[model samples]
Target: MATIFTIPGSLRSGSSNHNILKFLGTLVPDGINYTIYDSLATIPPFDPGLDNDTTPQPVAELHRLITNADAIIICTPEYAFGVPGQLKNALDWLVSSGTLVDKPVALITASSSGEYAHPSLLRTLGALSANVIEEACLLVPFIRARIQDGVLDDELKEQLESAFESLLKAL
Candidate 1:
C-alpha cells in the first residue's frame, strides 16, 4: 500500500490546519496509509552543529518519517505574515539531510490573507529541492471561516479534496 504523510504547521490543538488534515484523512481511499505527523513541537531548533550522524532524536525521527513516506502534505497558517517558526525550523533540519529532496510535496497556506506566507513557503520548498506538485498546491485565504463551513460547502470541500487527490496522483 502507498503511504502519505501530512504535517500541520500549526502546533495549536484543534487548529484549522489540523482540522484540514483530519478532513483530508476522510477522503483517503483504500489501499493507502495516511498518517499525520503531530510532533512539530518536539523538533528542536535547527543547529547545524547538531545535525549529523548523531542528530537529535526528534529530528532523526522526523527525517525517518519523511524519508519513508511516498508523498508529503504541508498545511499551514501564516503567523506575522510568515511561515510559523517551528515549521521553518523543522524544514531547516531537513536541509542538510536532503530528506525532502525530490520528494512529492503539496503545500497549503490556509489563513487570513495567506498571500505572503504562501509564496515564501513555496520558495522554501524549492530550496529544499522538493517536487512540489503545482496542481496540488493551494492558497486558501480566510481559512477559519471555510473550516467552520467544513463539509457543508461543496465548492470548498471539492477544492480541498482535489488537492489531496492531486497528491495521490503525483505518487
Candidate 2:
C-alpha cells in the first residue's frame, strides 16, 4: 500500500489548511495509507543542538513518518505574510535528518494572499533537496472565499484534484 502523509500548517481548530488536507484525504485511492498529521503544535522550537538521535519524541515521530511515506501533501496558510511559525519549525527539524530528501512532495499554500509564503516554502523545500512535484504545487489566494462551510468551490476542488493526481502519478 502507498503511504501518504499530510501536514496542515495551521494549528487553528477550524483552519482552512486542515480542512484542505481533509478534503485531499478523500481523493486517495483504495489501498493507500493516508494520514493527516495533527501534531505540528507539539513539535518544539528547532534547536540544532537537539537534532541528534535523541531528538524529541514528536520530532522523531515526524521524521519517521516522512521517511516512511511514499508522498507528502502540505497544505498551509500564510501568517504575517510568511510561513507559519510552527510549520517552519517542523521543517527545521527535518533539515538535519534529511528525511525529506528526494521525497515526493506536493505543496498547497491557501490564504488571503499566499504569494509570499508559497515561494518562500518552495525555497525551503529546495534547500532540503526534496523532489517537489512542480505540477502538484498550488497557490490559492483568497482561500477563504474558495471554501464555504468546509466545502471547496468547484474551481478550487478541480485544481486540488488535478494537483493530487499529479502527486499520485509521481508515486
Candidate 3:
C-alpha cells in the first residue's frame, strides 16, 4: 500500500485548506493510506543552530513521518501573497536534513488567489530537490467558494480527484 502524508498550511481549526485535505482523505483509492500531518503548530520555529541530531521532538517526528511516506501532498493557503510562515518554517527545517530530496510531492495551493504561492512553493520545493510532480501540482483558486459546510462541489471534487490521480500515477 502507498502512504500519503498530507500537510495543510493553516493552523486554524476548520480552515478551508484543512477541510479540503480531510475531504481528499475520503477519496483515496483502495490500498492507499492517507494521513494528515496535524502538528504544524506544535513544531517550534526553525533554528539552524539546533538542527542537529537532537532537534525538537516535533521536528523529529515530522521528519520521521515524511521519510516514511511514499508520497506527500501539500495543501496550502496564500498568506499576504506568500506561503504561510509556519509551513515555510517547516520546509526550512527540512532544507539541510535532505528529507524531501527526490521525494514525490504534489503541491496544491487552495486559496482566494492561489496564484502567488503556487510558483513560490514550487521554487522552494525545487531548491530542496523534491521530485515535484508537475502534472499533480494544482492551483485551486477561490477554494472557499468551491466548498461549503465541509463539502466540495462537483466541479471542485472532479478537479481534486484528477489531481489526486495524477499524484498516484506519478508515484
Candidate 4:
C-alpha cells in the first residue's frame, strides 16, 4: 500500500486548513494508507546546533515519519502574508537531514488569500530537493467559506480528490 504523510501547518484547533486535511484523510483510495503528522505543536524550535545524531525526540519522530512515508501532503494557512513560523521551523529541521530529497510532495495552501505562502512553501520544499507535483499543488482561497459544520462542500471535496489523485500518480 502507498503510504501518505500529511502535515497540517496550523496549531489552532479549529483551523480550516486542519479541517481540510482531516477531510482528505477520509477520502483516501483503497490500497493507500494515510496518516496525519499531528505533532507539529510538540516539535521544538529549530536549532542548527541540535541537528545531529542526537536529535530531540520530537524532531527525530518527525524525521522518522517523513523517511518512511511514500509521499507527503501539506495543507497550510498563510500567516501574516508568509509561511507560518511553526511550519517553517519544521521544514528547517529537515534541511540538512535529506529526508525530503526527491520525495513526492503535494502542497495545498488554504486560507482567505494564500498566494504568498503558496509560493514561499514551494520554494522551501524545492530547496529541500522535494519533487513537488505542480498539478497537485493548489491555492484554496476563502477556505473558511468552503467548510461548514466540520464538512467540506462537494466542490471542495472534488478538488481535494483531484489533488490527491495527482499526488498518487506522481508517486
**TM per prediction:** 0.96, 0.98, 0.97, 0.96
What residue pairs clash in candidate 4, if any at all? Answer: none
Candidate 2 off by > 4 Å: none
User: Per-residue error at 7 for model 3, in Å?
Assistant: 0.2
| Lowest summed lDDT window (length 10), candidate 2 | 11-20
Using TM-score as the measure, which candidate wins? 2
Q: Over the stretch 12-124, how does candidate 1's per-residue lDDT look in tens digits? A: 87788888888889999999999999899999889999999879999999999999999999999999989999999999999999999999999988889889889999999
Q: Compose the digit string of candidate 4's lDDT tens values, residues 106-141.
A: 999999899899999999999999999998999999
* Residue 64, model 1, lDDT: 91
lDDT of 3 by residue, 66-85 (tens): 99999999999999999999
Which one wins by lDDT: 1 or 3?
A: 3
Cand. 1 TM to true fold? 0.96
Rank the models by lDDT, top first.
2, 4, 3, 1
- Best lDDT goes to which candidate? 2
**Candidate 1 vs 2: which has more TM-score:** 2
- What are the C-alpha RMSDs, in order, of all predicted structures? 1.3, 0.7, 0.9, 1.0
Q: How many Å off is the CA of 38 in candidate 3?
A: 0.7
Residue runs of model 1 more than 4 Å from their true location after superposition: 149-152
Error of 2 at 168 (Å): 0.4
